[model samples]
Target: MKTAGGSDAAKRRAGERAAEDVADGFVVGLGTGSTTAYAIRALGRAVDDGLEIRGVPTSFQSRQLALEVGIELTDLDAVDGLDLAIDGADQVVDDADAAAHGALIKGGGAAHAREKLVDAAADRFVVVADPSKLTTRLERSVPVAVLPDAHTVVADRIRDLGGEPTLRDAGEKDGPVVTDNGNLVLDCAFGSIDDPDELATRLSAIPGVVEHGLFVGMADATYVGTDDGVETRHY
Candidate 1:
């Protein structure tokens, strides 16, 4: 059985290996999550060692982490585009041989909207994670960012699509969990996503849905860390 500590170590190794893809003079999109935190730290060390690069963080948490690590930071508005983006996925849907043809479920941290924007702007989006995150099918409840006023309607729409939607409650607060963009989250449980592309399309067609956790065909490559070592797959 895999322990949490061992998985975390793998996450760190995956992050570090992904950070090696960063180069001098590149404008990078820093991702949000524990696994990506390792990448941020590794990038910081590279910066200190004379690698000239700038980072656009995906969330406040990532921004603060980057600042503490001495990484030079920039806003998305300040850059025309990103050379690379490194992120972590809550669930990855791809085989070892599959490169770019895959999907992902993210937003465990409520920053999916911002993450999608940064990732889409990047020339290459690299996913870093422990091998434990990979799955033959993405069955995690998909996170949908909805307008506060549209939650009920969106929930109904999700139900129409055969999904059970629940408003995500804040663990530390007394209300629904709000995203960084001041919206609400609906965790739509569909059991197993059979057609990710079609599901993503249907979710996007919802009026109040700002964004969905389904990252369909967005990853350029992924680095998965296992007990033996890190493995890289391109798509």
Candidate 2:
């Protein structure tokens, strides 16, 4: 049986290729995840070669990685806008209406809220992932960041919305896993979402919901790594 090495190699290739898009003097929005970690390394190498670019990292993990690679960093507010954002998604589905566009579900690392904010601030958002991430529709569970005080209330609301919500627990510790923003995550399963936009709207309307992983019509392009090579899709 084939293990995940192929997939991991694919992610590294996709990340390196995505990093090639970063140009000198550009302010890049660094995203989180294993795939984006490769991008960070590539970007760091470019920085060593004197690529005068600055990075705005979306997560603490990303920030540390960028620093280790010697990528110059700055705050999001310090920059007018990001030239590009290279990130990864848990799932990518083609838009039902427009085949060119993709609807993404992210936050597998529980950093979707910050990822969305940074991605939205960029002039171009690029998602890099292995081909395994592509799907006909988003069937994976959606991750919703909720205020700690409203975790139970939000889970109840999600249940009423036809989802099975589970409060994400920490792997090492006993209590729940808290986010950088001091929020908790609810992994809500709604099966294969036929209409993600509609569901996203409904989830957003719920009080105490900070942000969800349903990224509707946000991807400018996606770089998918396959057994053959990297495939590029533009939206």
Candidate 3:
């Protein structure tokens, strides 16, 4: 329930807790984000201890981290399915539908497109985050990945949908932030999201939109870390 900026300790707690679910001989989807990085490192330690598992990284960052940690890497093409996936969210809220897991706003790192594919393929998807990432309602800017040539057109369509879209710029480089798939990101702010599913559909309806940050009913559980401990919420 905490909403302030999450401390480093909290992020580590949530991440490491999620990593405990990984088992030997399982195929795991390694997610991208600072919190998920801890989970990756933990898995690396497990591998060092002789726990064998294959990882399908959701982003270049995660792929590099997985290699650095010595986790064996595999692509989605090589695996029929994943046993589990551990990811992080920019913001999370309980799903509107009671039977569904939860709604999440991701893509703060511009990797949501690939993250979605890897996550949805897993039998179980777990979200690792600090309490600060949870919210009663999702209001963060939604990231929409679009083809570079279609960015302008997508922006116009997004504006017509009553949302303000800003092309995300790279912090350490010039020009717009380019995704690993060679797409541009539009961080669209829609204020408080009343219906995430409806919005997700609208966003996906736009041509050239590769993916969006709204993750509705995708998470199976969320591990939220606090200053002193961790809490698990099941959907």
Candidate 4:
């Protein structure tokens, strides 16, 4: 039996297309999530093809996945500037066709902060995702990373902001799901996030809050994959 890793093969092919866009010998920033799994696999193929590139994964899961795929990995301290970052976006949209201008909600893997660190260090941040994620406005479904000791206090603070916060879990494990950064994650549902930038900034400012998963102005361009094919929207 030939299983397609529980994801569509065409989606994986779309990741190949994006990987082809990457030049050899550049420091790449790897992202986390299911969609990014394909990208990492594709990038690994590139490495096998004799590209002398080094990868810096955004999360421990991403790092492990990259190693399994044959991509040479590196640490942040070893590299000063990242040439490119190929990762997945939760959502995307175009603002008047003046390149792509849509905010994104990420961090489902609880590695949002590390993703941001790599994205910020990169020269170009390329976001990849399915077409269904495109939206005119950013909705905050981002899992907020916090300390377990302050989960209740943080949830209350979020509730005061009209957000019903729920502690993210790994299916009744008798405890909270811990992030790669060794913090607890809160899967927050704040309805339609009217202002993602402001909300992200505010949430990040809160104490005990390690990082929020919303990525604003962090993408240079986005590649949206559809059932038919893929398309690029530069921002």
Rate residue 180 of model 4 by lDDT: 82
- Estimated TM-score for each candidate: 0.95, 0.95, 0.95, 0.90
Worst 10 residues of 3 by lDDT: 94-103
Candidate 3 local lDDT, 67-159, one digit each (tens) = 999999999999999999999999999544543247899999999999999999999999999877888788999999999999999999999
What lDDT tens digits, residue by residue, belong to model 4 across residues 1-235?
Answer: 1233223654565576667777878889988877778888888877887888889999888999999988889988798889988777665655644222656787766788788889889999888776556787666566888887888888888887778888887775787888887899988888777777778787887778888878888888777766667777776
**Which candidate, 3 or 4, has the higher lDDT?**
3
Give one digit per residue, the lDDT tens place, for model 2 in 52-165: 999999899999999999998999899899999999999998544644258999998899999999999999999998878888788999999999999899999999999999
Q: Model 4, stretches more than 4 Å misplaced?
A: 1-7, 93-100
lDDT of the candidates, in the order given? 0.91, 0.90, 0.92, 0.78
Name every residue pair that clashes in candidate 2: none
Off by over 4 Å in 2: 1-6, 94-101
Candidate 2, 160: how far from true, in Å? 1.5
Sort by lDDT, best first: 3, 1, 2, 4
Clash count, one per candidate: 3, 0, 0, 0
True lDDT of residue 23, candidate 1: 89
Alpha-carbon runs more than 4 Å astray in model 3: 1-4, 94-101
What lDDT does candidate 4 reach at residue 127? 84
Model 2 global lDDT (CA atoms, 0 to 1) = 0.90
Give me candidate 2's TM-score against the actual structure.
0.95
| Residues 1-235, model 1: lDDT tens digits | 4555347779888999999999889999999998999999999999889999999999999999999999989999999999999999999877655432558999989999999999999999999988778887889999999999999999999999999999999999899998888999999999988888899999999999999999999998889888778988777
Distance from true location, Cα of 3 in model 3, Å: 13
